[model samples]
Target: MSAPQHPTETASTAEATSGAVLSPVPDDVDTAPTELPDADPDSADAVVEPVDATGGADGAGGTDALLVTEGDVAGDYLERLLDILDVDGDIDLDVEGDRASVAIVGAELQDLVGSDGSVLEALQELTRLAVAQSTGVRSRLMLDISGFRAKRRADLTSLAGEAARRVAASGQPERLAAMNPFERKVVHDVVAGITGVHSESDGEEPNRRVVVLPDR
Candidate 1:
């Protein structure tokens, strides 16, 4: 039997059917440093400390620049994907904290988001891999489609506050339904802001849930 086709696949391009993989890296883009200078035994300064390739001596500036590059790479990759799929959408990129954030906003993007944002999650992983392939460093880039994550974040924040209140009032632990990593992180952040209560994740992936506990 033939392999299943992605929901976003079209007759125009059979090669781009695999939404999990990005285009191969170009031969001209060197992924590694060419060489290092030889150390001289006669000089005391010959022994040099290893430098961080991703983020240099100025940690903040280097890290910010890397994140910007990640956003740009991700944007370009996503743009090509949209073109292949013949899907119309606008890509917006930004650097949020230590990670890069990208969002695709336009009509008829529900298919890309999939049910419960499953497809969106897969696309995000693919985009991160593409950025890593170009920069030779793993990326923690976040992707959102049609404001799904933004709205979800708001909803989760509210739910977390409610759960925290309930736990605080009854002095009992409350466990929420299973949530993905992104959802769990939002809940954890909200719960952290409220006093007298804390949150902990339990169970395995796809079944993991957050438990709100009152501080003793």
Candidate 2:
């Protein structure tokens, strides 16, 4: 994957409490550039595990309750952020499957999305931290601004489908560019639905990519 694009403006870390002002980053959050590890041509196949957006197992009543709390906490936290930035946006919160899903919809919020969503990723981690600070548990809340992630998901789904078809026809493996956990999961899911092919992850964080393999 490419290096994280840092925002021009910075903010000091603050408490995640109500009315707390959070910077684009928190002091504890790591913004270091993630270097792509070298690829091992002979590496074993490692299936990319499905990511649980809720950060918990499915079908537990307590998990559902916690997800609701996560949404509430994250919504409040994001609202405060928009207020601070003087940006007008609507905060939509929901419990999707086992995870808390929050979306910010409005005009002129592309800056929050940043280059290739680096800024949005930073904000998401910070929001999760905020939720954890309040709930005393780690959060797996997913955040989106201006529908950037939605569009990206559609594009990735199409790309994975095309790659799967090519691999199945050629009976050869195709290595995709490194992707974040979210992007990898999208590709994995799409590939899983297709016949005659499968997908696995290789390399390390920020460099880990999906490999489409034709089933022998």
Candidate 3:
């Protein structure tokens, strides 16, 4: 078992939340620097602080229009910002469960994804905030750039399977590399499906990772 550490401590002392590890506290050793310029949150992303947009609100249902509204807000914000950035991409919006989802579609938009999709993750947060500001409520909007998230999901699922196999064969724990919250969740889900192995989170944000344990 790894030693537990405070949330503010280094990655070595990291602890897990939700029984699994990983994601952006916006810092950690696993994080890769991106090529995109540091964004100005106060600029186009937050420029529209209007409320009264429809769709999602507090306690929205799965099929609620609120999520769509949230997507619209985020999509509009992203579209305008992309135009300013001179990035040629089409923003697609969808109401995915209780959250709004947005994807920047276009081959030329790879630079927006950055190294290890760090730029995309940061952009996602900004989009969610933009939706919240426009709707006068919090938003749980997911963002994807150039199908990077889709590809990452497939890879993480495979990683979880490999980790499970290793744990089952060794009858020991296997700690995975640091990942983001979304990535960790996918890995945990995969771990839950297999027998004789269980998963737990370790470390802090940005450096937190999943640890697979064999059935003792």
Candidate 4:
């Protein structure tokens, strides 16, 4: 069967449909291979990171400049996709840290955002594939729809802090409910910053969960 049109489509999405997996990991947060802290929206650092070739069901290597190339390719692909779906939205591009970030804004994006932003994640993966196909290199193009990702990051940061506190007080690792790669990364980033607490993934994909560990 064909994959759904959402951004967070599975490893099978590109592998089944295009047979090219971009990120070195099973997914790139769905684009980046390794998860890095998100750049502050108020900050203008290049925040894009390429998919790590060592991390995917199938991985490909790419250069640093390739990150910007991903942004351009994804911008064009998303522009065309919106036209096809008859959605009205504007595309904004940025290079923060070492990654390509693209946002779809200035329109009604609730449906695209979907329940808990699942649709947005699927769409982002598709956009990354588009970039990979165009550049003939794996693309870890980060896609944001209607600012959902920004809001999510803010929420995750808070959630992680709370989880860390619980672990520190109890002196027992607290296991978070299962989360997707992107969500897990958000938690990992926050947990990593908390003194005396660390986080790691434990389990297989889809059911993979994060555990916040306190320094013993």
Candidate 5:
């Protein structure tokens, strides 16, 4: 048997039923890999860094220019993606609070959002990495394609609110099914906004789930 291929390194380059992955390295991005902070040797949790939410206009407590730069980088990267895929689209860039947001609008771009938004998720991470590389700062900029994510967010918000209400009435913690990190964040944030409920993520990735718990 041949050696196994690590998904993280090769998945981005593989061609599946949908579109082939665009170049992971955007042309404008520097060739050098980012030198991220060293992991804490003593803690397994060190792999995760707390999101800087205290700065900038988004409450990140840093310069707004970083967000703007991130937006610019994402916009340029998205334009190239459209060109590479032979699709025509216009990218809109904006800074919502402290995070940059990029949206693609066009009729022919629907395929970019594969079944269940798998492609969109990958593209979002790649875009974030591109921005991070360009600015030498981590970014949480949200990318939206054809309003799929916007609609999904609205749906998830409603679901989380309903779950929160039920949990409050039944006094039972509702464990949501497995979700991606981004989806869990949406559920957690939505539930956290309501009274008498809190959200926590459990399990490992790809199968990790969110549990909406009653406030103690």
Candidate 6:
């Protein structure tokens, strides 16, 4: 038998009390970058005081501000990460619904994704922690590299669609291979969208998976 997998080490580390701030950015289909004038650190530092807009006693004002600030902090953090790894990329930020979203687009970032995106998941949790520490707000930020996940989601969605069709035709529950939470979520979503099909997650972390069932 294959050895069992463990729960995400970073998931347990998140300080649950901190709130996650997400500000959705309007979609811009173009992923290309436009060059800007070089940054002047001295002038830049003098212009703004970095404060966690997500922190403090502003009450209602803090909510929206916190969302935007989380994006800024996350962008800076991702930039530093790229620098340290000697990778080149453009960072894009947006807040959609209730989550802050960040995407890194570059040609040379495959290493960051790792096999099956295990490394990306770890990096995302760590980045969220960094944002939380800076803004004093827990962030459930979603990070994407080279659109690897976007493509993966599309593929999974198609696979789920096929599985759901087969299950409806065969009238049997589909037991799929084990998948990470993100992948399972994609499958569940695709299957759930169709008529007379239902999906649920079964098992536990790491080994946890989704099972698609025919409607009764």
Candidate 6 to native Cα RMSD, angstroms = 17.4
Candidate 6, 1-216: lDDT as tens digits? 111221111111011112211111123422121111111122211122333532644454555467667778878888888888888888877765445677777788878887767678878878888987887666766777777667666666666788778777876666565666556656666776787767665556655555666677
Q: Summarize candidate 1's per-residue lDDT along 158-212 as a digit string, tens digits.
A: 6778878877787767667766666666677788778887776655766656667
Residue-level lDDT for 179 in candidate 3:
66
Q: Would you list the C-alpha lDDT of every candidate in the order shown?
A: 0.66, 0.65, 0.61, 0.61, 0.61, 0.60
Q: Candidate 2's residue-wise lDDT over 164-213, tens digit each?
A: 89888987677676666666666777888899887776668767667777
- Model 4: runs farther than 4 Å from truth? 1-64
Write the residue-wise lDDT of candidate 4 on 92-125 in tens digits. Answer: 7776544667878756878887776678878877
Model 3 pairs whose backbones collide: 14-203, 15-203, 19-201, 20-201, 21-201, 23-180, 55-65, 55-66, 56-66
C-alpha TM-scores of all predictions: 0.75, 0.73, 0.70, 0.70, 0.70, 0.69
Point out the worst 10-residue segment of candidate 6 by lDDT: 7-16
Weakest 10 consecutive residues, lDDT, candidate 5? Answer: 5-14
What value does the lDDT take at residue 37 in candidate 2? 24
RMSD of 2: 14.2
Which of 4 and 6 is the better model by lDDT? 4
**Could you tell me which 10 consecutive residues in candidate 3 have the lowest summed lDDT?**
4-13
State candidate 2's TM-score. Answer: 0.73
